[model samples]
Target: MPPDSDPTEYKVGRLIDKYDLDGLGQELEDRWLGRGYESQSLRSLADWFNKYILEEKFNRAGEPPMDGEIDNIYRLLTDDEVTSGMRLDAETALEEKDIDPENTRKEFVSHQSVYVYLTEHRGASKQHSSKDRIGSARDTIQRLQSRLIAVIENHLEQLRNAGELTIGEFTVLIDIQILCEDCGSSYSLTDLFDRGGCDCE
Candidate 1:
């Protein structure tokens, strides 16, 4: 790809290479195309574009600069600063659930850390586990996920309104899992949250 290639024609990979984004391209690609290197779909491209602009580029606490351009838009999604704050919040949530956040932090060191922490710690004995406690933990995780989705959607809407992102409408899909370790079973976190608990017995 030429240095002067139209920014609109730049696919996720080319953009990553041109900007030296390293692992971000692969991570975005994986989220879009799974583990395969298949052709990019409109949904994937739009999803990536929205997230890159909203989360990585746009500032929530202040107005975006008037000089914001295409180059200014492309940024590293896994930039340590972004994930570090999320990691700290995940650690705090894990501690509230009586799970040792230190080991959980070390084990799942990515955006999925919250889900991983919950799955790893859902081992409370049937006799000892309180329904109320489980319910509270489930609420916490659900709230966290919901807040994330809301923030993304809010930013996407702002971009659409501002004419920054010109793509058609799209939805953000969050796939989170809750595991019943004792029974070797798994359920969607959304379902588990709705049902109030897993039917592991």
Candidate 2:
């Protein structure tokens, strides 16, 4: 007599072989085959993977070394160079109008956080004599954005090549968000994949 053939059993066996999940496989086999859970086999296994294995096992198996890159980019964007350019322009304006530089700078820093200030001001005033400084700062920001995206995409490509993840799976895991430099618009990974990048000119 041949052994009983079950599709869920086959799938579980394959997962065990592929991932070397010896202990979990034994537990699952005992629960589904030995116990009376054969009817709910696949669902039970899927729930297990979702609740425990996805983060605990699968993510740990293939984590990349991109945290440092991300941190570097974030720090560059928020560094004093960028903030000082804005401060200098504001200071110039305040000084021209005979306002107290020290007190006004403190007030500006307190009222407007770095991100809010950068997004709101964009660059120095057109009439101010810091046009070059503004242009340089904008260029630096654009470069950093491009570099960050490139680093992330390269890492994703490596993971895909290693067969650790598919592009779809990777996108879901990362939940990527892109910012359009020209239009200051934000996009999701799904939106980028579906629509082929932002619609900025």
| Most accurate candidate by lDDT | 1
* Tens digits of per-residue lDDT for model 1, 1-201: 112333222233333444455666334444433446553332334434444433332233233434542222222222345566665664454345454444322222223322222222222111224656765665576457746866887899899999998866554546677789887767666456546667766
- lDDT values for all models: 0.45, 0.40
Cα distance off (Å), candidate 2, residue 47: 1.1
Per-candidate clashes come to 0, 0
Worst 10 residues of 2 by lDDT: 108-117
Per-model TM values vs. the true structure: 0.28, 0.21
- 47-117, model 2: which lDDT tens digit per residue? 44323332233234353224343233223323456676665664554445454455422222110122111
Q: Highest TM-score among the candidates is held by which one?
A: 1
* Whole-structure CA lDDT of model 2: 0.40
lDDT for 37 in candidate 1 is 53
